[model samples]
Target chain A: MKISRIVSLVIVLIAASYFLVPLYATFQFSLQMLRGQWSFQAYRSVFADPNFLSTLSYSAVTSLVAILISTLIVVPTTYWVRLKMPRVKPVVEFITLLPLIIPPIVIVFGYLRLYGSDSLLPLTVSSAGTNLMLVIGYATLSLPYVFRSVDNGMQTLDIRTLTEAAESLGANRSTIIFRVILPNLRAAIVSGAFLTFSISFGEFVFASLLNRPAFGPYLVQIGQDRAYEPAALAVLSFALTWACMVLMQIFANAKPGASRRRRGAAFNPLARRKTA
Target chain B: MTVADDLLNPPSQGGSARSAPAGLPGAKAPRRANWAWLGLLPFALFAAFFLILPIVYLVTGAFQTPEGTFTFDNLIALTGPAILGSYWLSIKLSLVSALLGAAAGLLLSWALVLGGLPRWVRGAFITFSGVASNFAGIPLAFAFIATIGRLGIVTVLVRELFGFNIYGAGFNLFSFWGLALTYLYFQLPLMVLIITPALDGLKTEWREAAESLGASHAQYWRMVALPVLSPSILGCFLLLFANAFGTLATVYALTGSQFDVVPIMLFAQIRGNVLYNPNLGYALALGMILIAGLSNVLYLVLRSRAERWRA
Candidate 1:
C-alpha cells in the first residue's frame, strides 16, 4: 500500500511538472528583459506598443460580436429542438459537430473561395464585409461548443413544463423564449460565450487569413521578431485563457436559481403579479 | 459519452414536448408540425452560409481546373513527393503526440482517480486541465520556446547545473520531436479531461470481483479493467489524434515556414506566396477533412460501444 501511494505521488508530481514547467520558464524568461536583473521590462515594452492595445481591442470586440451571434443562433435552435422539433435533433446535432471535423483553416479557405471579390454576394470585397465574414467564421467555429453547452443546460430543465406553464399564462412564444427560457439558460450561455470569446480572441488562422488586425496575428508577429516580449505576451495570453476558464467554471457551478431568480421574477408574469 | 451521444439521446424520456400541446384542436396539430421546422431557419441559414457551403465549395473546387473546367489534376498533384512528404510528416507527428499524450494522460488520470489520491488533488488537476486544454495555438508555442528553445531557461539550467548541453546533443526544439513534445502541452490535459470520466466509471466492484475470483492485480487489470476501459481509451486516443492533426498555429509559430506540415503548406498556398496552387490546397484541405472525419466517426462508434459499460 505504501509503495503504491509513493508511486502515485511520483506520477502526479511528474505530470504536474509537465504542466507547470513551461509556464514557470516563460514567466521567468519574460522577466529577463533587463541586462542583468529580473524586471518587467518585457511587459512594459509590450504594453507600450500601440499595436498591442489596438489588436487586442479589435479581437475583443470581434469576439464579443461572434459570441452574440453564436448565442442568438444556438440558444434558439437548441430550445426549439428540445421543445418543438425533437425529430430534427439529429440534423441539428450533425451540423453543430461538423465544425469539429472541418478544420478552421479549411473553413477559412473555403470562405475566401466562395465569398471572394469575384463571387456573388462577395463578402470579402470590402473591409467591413470581410470583418463580418470573420465574425461569421468565428461563430461557425464556436457552434459545436455553444450548441452542446446550451443543450446540456436545457437538458437540466423540464422545457415542456416551462413552456406549457408560460403558455397557460397567455405568454407568446417570443416572450417565453426571451424571458423564461433565456433567463434559465443564462449560465450556459455565459459559459459558452466565454469559451467562444477565448477561442476568437486569440484565433490565428481565420483572423490572419482574412487579413484582420487581431490579437493572434499580433502575437505571432511579435513571436517572429521579439524574444522577451513574446514570452511576456504568452504569460498575458495564458492569464486571459485562465481568466476565461475560471469565469466559465464559476458560472457553470453557480446554482441555477442564484442569478436566475431575479431575472425570472422580473419577466415572469406569475411571479410579477404575485410579488406585486 | 461524447456530445454527439448526448445530443442524439432524447432530451426528455417521458415528457415529450411535442405532446404537451395535444389539447389543441386536431387540425392545429398537423399545421404546428409543419411549421415547427421554421424555428430552425436561422440556425440552418447560418450553418449553410458559414459552415456547409464553404466546405462544399472546397470539395467541388478540388476537382476543378484553374479556368473552372473539371479536372483530376489537382488531386493527382497531391501525390507529388513534396506534398506526400508533408502529409507523411504530419501523420507521423500527430500519431506520436497522440499516442504519448494518451499514455501519459491515462496514467495521470489513473493515479488521481484510482491511486487513492486526496480528493482535492483531483479537483485542482481537473481545473488546471480545463485551462490548459484550451490554452493552445500561438501562446503555447511561445511557452514551449521560452522553456526549451536554444537559449531557453531549461536549456541554460541543464547546461549550468549538470554541464549537460541539450542543444549540443542535437535536442533541437524546432524539429519533429520538439513539436510533438509541445503538442502534449494541450493534448495531455485534453486527454485527462476526457478520460477521467471513463476512469471514474470503472466501478470498485469490478476490481473486487476480480480479486475474489483469485486474480492477481495484473490479471485483474488485464482481464477485467482494461477490456472495459479499452473502448473509451481508444476513442479518446482518436480524439487526441484528430486534435493534434488539425493544429496549425502552434507548429507555424515554432518552426516558421521551414517546417513543411500540410497546414503550413496549405497556408503558403492560400497566401499565394511560394505555393500558388489553390486547387491543390483544396485537395489538401479535403484530405485533412477526410482524416479528421474518419477518426471522429470511429470515435463516435467506439463511444457508443463504451456506453454499454457506462450503463
Candidate 2:
C-alpha cells in the first residue's frame, strides 16, 4: 500500500511538471522582453498592437455567433429527437460525431473548394459572406460537444413526462418548449456554449483558410515574426482556455433544476400568506 | 409496446373518426411521424452542405484530372518517394507518440483512479486534462518552444546547472522527436480523460473473485483485468493516433511548412504551392481522411465492444 502511494506521488509529480513547466516557461519568457530586467513590455506591446485587439474581438464575436447558431440548431433538434423521434437519435449522433473524425483543415479545404468565388454559391466572395462561412464551420466543429451536453441534459429531465404535465396544465406547445424546456436546459447549453467558445476562439484552420483576421491566425503570424510577443500571446491564450474550462466546470456542476427551485422559494411566501 | 403496435397496425380512416371521442389516457394519439423527419431537416441539410459534401468533393476530385477526366494519375503520384516519405514519417511519428502517450497516460490514470491518492488530486488532474487537451495549436507550439527550444528555459537551466547541453546532443526542437514531444502535451491528457472511466468501470468484485479462485496478482491482471481494459486501451490508442495524425497548426507553427506532415503538405498545396496539380491535393486530403476515419471507426467499434463487456 505504501509502495502504491509512493508510485502515485511520483506519477503525479512527473505529470504536473510535464504540464506546468511549459506554462511557467512561457510566462517567464513573456516577462523577459526588457533587457536585464523582468518586465511587462511584451504584454504592453501585445496590447498596443491593433491587430491583436481586432483579431481577438473578431474571433470573440464570431465565437459568440457560432455558439448562438449551434444552440439555436442543436437545442430544438435534441429536444425534438428525444421527445418525438428517438429512433433517429443514432443518425443525429453519428452526424454530430463526424466533425470529430473529420479534421478541421479537411473540412475547411472542402469549403474553400465548394464555396469559392465563381462557384454557384460564392460564400467566399464577400468578407461578410466569408465571416458567415466561418461561423457555420465553427458550429459544425462544435456539434459533438453541444449535442452531447444537451442530450445528457434532456435525458436527466424526463422530457416526455414534463411535456405531458405541462400540457395537462393547459400550456401550449410553444409555451412549454420556450418556457418550460429551455429553462431546464440552461446548464447544459451554457456548458456547451463555453466549449464552443474555446474551440472557435483559437480555431486556426478555417480562419486561416478563409483568410479571416481571427485570433488563431494572428497568433501564428506573431509566432513567426516576433518572439516575446508570441510567448505573451501564448500565456494569454492559455489563460483564455483556462477561463473557459473553469466556467464549464462550474456549469457542469450546477443543478439543472436550481433556477426552478429558486423561483419556487421566492413565491413560497406569497403562497403561505394566501393560505393563512 | 404502443410504439411497436403503431408500427404494426395503421389506424384505418374510419377508425380515427370512431376513436376521436373515445379519447382515453391509455391510448396514444396518432402522431404525425413525418413531422419528426421534418424536425431533423435543418441539421441534416447543414451537415450535408458542410460535412458530407466536402468529403464527397475530395473523394471525387481525387480521381479527376485537370481537364475534368477521371484518372488514377494523382494516386499514382502519391507513390513517389517524396510524398510517400512524408506519409511514412507522419505514420511513424503518430504511432510513436500515441504509444508513448497511451502507456504513460494509462499509468497516470491508473495511479489517480485506483491508487491511494487524495480525492482532490484526481479532480485536479481531470480538470487540468480538460484544459490541456484543448490547449493545442499555435500557442501550444510557442509554449513548448519557450520551454525546450535552443534558448528555452529548461535547455538553459540544464546546461547551466548540470553542464550538459541538450542541443549539443543533436536534439533539434524542429525535428520529429521535438514535434512528438510537443504532441504529447495534448495526447497524454486526452488519453487520461478517455481511459479514466474505463479504469473506473473495472469492478472490484472481479479481482476479489479471481483472488478467491487462487489466482496471483499478476495472474489476476493478466486473466481478468487486462481483458476488460484492453478494448478501451486500444480504442484510446487509436484515438490518440488519429488526433496526432490530423494535427496541422501545431506542426506548422513549431516547425514551419518545411517539415512535411501530410496536413502541412496539404496546407501548402491549398495555399497555391500545388506543383500545378490540384488533383494531387485532393488525393492528399483523401489520404488524411482515410487514416483519420479508419482509426476513429475502429475506436468506435472497440468502444461499443467495451461497453458491452461492462454491461
Candidate 3:
C-alpha cells in the first residue's frame, strides 16, 4: 500500500510538472525581455501595439456574436427536440456532431471555394461579409459543445411537464420559451457560451482563411517575428483559457433552485423500506 | 397549414385535421409529422448554408476540373511525391503523438484514480486537464518555443546543469519529434479528460472478485480490468489521433512553413497563387475530411461499445 502511494505521488508529480513547466517557462521568458533583468517589457509591448488592440477586439466581438448565434440556434432546437420532436432527437444529435467529423481547415477550405467572389453568396468579397462569415464559421465550430450542454441541461429538467404547466397557466409559446425554458437553461447557456467564446476567440483557421484580422492570426504573426512577446501572449492566452474553463465549471455546477431545494429534503431509510 | 397553426394545436389534438380529411386518422398523423419536422427547419437550413453546402461543394469540387468538367486527375495528383510526403509526415507525427499521449495520460489517470491519490489531487488534475486540452494553436506553439526552442529556458538549463547541449545531439525543436512533443501538451490532457470517466466506471467488485478467486494483482488486471477498459482506451486513442491529425495553426507557427503538414500545405495553396490548383486543394481537403471522419467514426463506435460495458 505504501509503495503504491509513493508510485502515485511520483506519477502525479511528473504529470503536474509537465502541465506547469511550459507555463512557468513561458511566464519566466515573458518577464525577461529587458535583457539581463526581469521586467514586464514583453507584456507592455503586446498591450501597446495598435494591431493587438484591433485584432483582440475583433476576435472578442465576433466570438460574442458567435456565442449568441449558437445559443439562439441550439436552445430552441434542443428544447423542441426534447419537448415535441423526440423522434428526431437522433437526427438532431447527429447534425450537432457533424462539426467534430469535419475538420475546421477543411470546412474553411470549402468556404473559400463555395463563397468566393464569383459565387452567388460572395460572402468573402467585402470585409464586412467576411466578418459575418467568420461569425457563422465560429457558430458552426461551437455547435457540438453548445448542443451537448443544452441537451444535458434539458435532460435534467422535465421540459414536458414545465411546458404543460406553462400552457395551462395561459402562457403563449414565446412566453413559455422566454420565461420558463430560457431561465431554466441559463446555466447551461452561459457555460456553452463561454466554451464558444474561448474557442472562437483564439480560433485560427476560419479567421485566417477568411482574411480577418482576428486575435489568432495576429498571435501567429507575432510568434513568427517576435521573441519574448509571443511568450507573454501565450501566458495571457493560458490565463484566458483557464478563466473560461473555471467559469464554465462554476456555472455548470450551479444547479437551479428547483433542483437544489429537492436535494435538501432528507429521506429516511426506514420510511423508504416501509413504503417499498 | 402554417407552422403557427401546427404549434397552436399540437399533433395529439388532431391539428392536421384542417389540412387533411377530419375522420382519416392515418392522413392526420403523416401531416402532423411533417409539420413537426418543420421545427427543425431553421437549424437544418443554418447547417445546410454554413456547414453542409460548403463541404459538399468541396467534396464535389474534388473530382472536377478547374473549368468545371469531371476529372480524377486531381485525386490522382495526391499520389505525387510532395503531397504524399506531407500526408505521410503528418500521419507519422499524429500517430507518434497519439500513442505517447495516450500511454502517458492513462498512467496519469490510473495514478490519480486507482493508485489511490488524495481526492483533491484528482480534482485539481481534472480541472487542469479541462483547460490544458483547450489550450492549443498559436499560443501553444509559443509556450513550447519558450520551453524547448533553440534558446529556450529548458534547453539552457539542460546545457548549464549537464554540460551538454541538446541541439548538439541533433535535437532540433523545429523537427518532427519536436512538433510531436509540443502536440503532447494538449493531446495528453485531452486523453486524461476523456479516459478519466472510463477509469471511474471500472467497478471495484471486479477486482475483489478476481482476488477472491485467487487471482494475483497482475493477473486480475490482465484478465479483468484491461479487457473491460480496452474499448475506451482504443477509442480515446483514436480521438487523440483525429485531434492531432486536423491541427494546423500550432504546426504552422512552430515550423513556419519549413515542415509541410497537409493542413499547412492546403493553407498555402489557398493563400498563394504559386503552384495553385483549386481542384487539387479540394482533393487535399477531401483527404483530410476522410481521415478525420474515419477516425472519429471509429471513436464513436468504440465509445458506444465501452458505454455498453459501463452500463
TM-score of chain A of each: 0.91, 0.90, 0.91
Q: lDDT tens string, model 3, A1-276?
A: 888889989999988998899999989989999989999999999999999989999999998888889888988888888867788798887787888777888888778878898999898999989988889988888788788777767777888889888877877677878899989989877877776676668888888879899998899899878999999999998899889878877777775644432211010000000000
Count of backbone clashes for each model? 0, 0, 0
Per-residue lDDT of B297 in model 2 = 79
For candidate 2, state the interface root-mean-square deviation in angstroms to 1 decimal.
12.6
- TM-score each candidate: 0.91, 0.91, 0.94
Choose the strongest candidate by TM-score.
3
For model 1, residues B100-141, the per-residue Cα lDDT tens digits are 999999999989997888999998998888778778899999
- Candidate 2 segments exceeding 4 Å error: A168-172, A257-276, B1-31
The candidate, 1 or 2, that scores higher on TM-score is 1
Maximum-DockQ candidate: 3
The list of candidate 1 runs beyond 4 A from truth reads A255-276, B1-29, B273-275
- Model 3 CA deviation exceeding 4 Å by range: A257-276, B12-29, B273-275
In the predicted model 1, the residue pairs found to clash are none
Error of 2 at A148 (Å): 0.8
lDDT of 2 by residue, B157-256 (tens): 9999999999999998899999999989888988888888788899999999998999998999899999899999999899889888888889988887
DockQ of each: 0.38, 0.35, 0.38
